[model samples]
Target: MIWQLDLILCLFIIICAIAAINVKDLLGAVIILGAYSFFMCLLWTEMGAVDVAFTEASVGAGVGTVLFIAAVSKTKRRSKD
Candidate 1:
């Protein structure tokens, strides 16, 4: 595996993680979390875990994001606190 690719993917994952956590908007944070999952899927694929990568792509980046978005759309975007 190319170390540079792994490093870049890791950096992306970290950035997504931080961005998701720090974002004030619930929808934006969910989108960032989905991006983080995609990066994680890529990293797993690069490390020779195609099965895990596929699962992550389908579940983590796919259904999970959709579910979160659906839930978010059903409610208010911000909290009263």
Candidate 2:
């Protein structure tokens, strides 16, 4: 069961990463990146690294997503150059 869950999480992370790169909207890409981070945190937890998972969840999924969205908001949604 644990291995199955880990496999699922890995697959989810991969899908989120692809979505993050392919999404046309900057905000959507940022959101997908956050989802990828969340799956990574889950993978860490499955690997018996609770502390690392907590840190990833807090920094990667939380603070990082906020920063990305803030940076995106500061510029135009679509870049001409």
Candidate 3:
């Protein structure tokens, strides 16, 4: 049962990673990367690493995402294409 949950999380993480890389829009890719970080945090928590998970959640999904968004906003470049 726990393994099943882990498998599901891994699948979603993989999908998010692929989407983040494939996305042409910088903002969209950043958002997807945030989602990937969130899922990774979840996986870490599930694996009994609560401390690491919290760090990943706060830094990866929180401040990191905010910083990325701020940078993108300042640049105002929509997409490469």
Candidate 4:
């Protein structure tokens, strides 16, 4: 059961990563990146790395997302090239 959950989380992380790259809008991509990080944190927890998972969850899902969004907001939403 636990292995199944881990596999699902890994798949979800991959999907989020693909979505982040394929999304047309910068904000949407950043949001998806955050989702990717969240899944990564889940994967870490499932693997029994609680400390690493906590850090990943805090930095990846929290500070990293905020920074990416702020950076995106400072620039144009669409790419010129």
Model 1 Cα lDDT, one tens digit per residue, 11-78: 99999999988888889899999999999999999999999999999988999999999999999777
Model 4 RMSD vs true structure: 1.6
Error of 3 at 44 (Å): 0.4
**Residue pairs clashing, model 3:** none
| lDDT measured at residue 25 in model 2 versus the true structure, 0 to 100 | 84
Any idea what lDDT model 4 has?
A: 0.88
Per-model lDDT: 0.93, 0.88, 0.93, 0.88
Q: Ten residues in a row with the worst lDDT in model 1?
A: 72-81
Model 3 Cα shift for residue 71 (angstroms): 1.0
Order of candidate numbers by TM-score, starting with the best: 1, 4, 2, 3
Candidate 1 vs candidate 4: which has greater lDDT?
Answer: 1
Tell me the tens digit of each residue's lDDT in model 3 across 1-81. Answer: 289989999999999999998888999999999999999999998999999999999988999999999999899746764
Measured against the true structure, the TM-scores of the candidates, in listed sequence, are 0.93, 0.91, 0.91, 0.92
Off by over 4 Å in 3: none
- lDDT against true structure, model 1: 0.93
Task: Provide the RMSD of all predictions against the true structure, rounded to 1 decimal.
Answer: 1.5, 1.9, 1.6, 1.6
Q: Give lDDT tens digits, candidate 4, residues 1-81.
A: 298998899889889988889888889888899889888988998899999999999987999999988998998898532
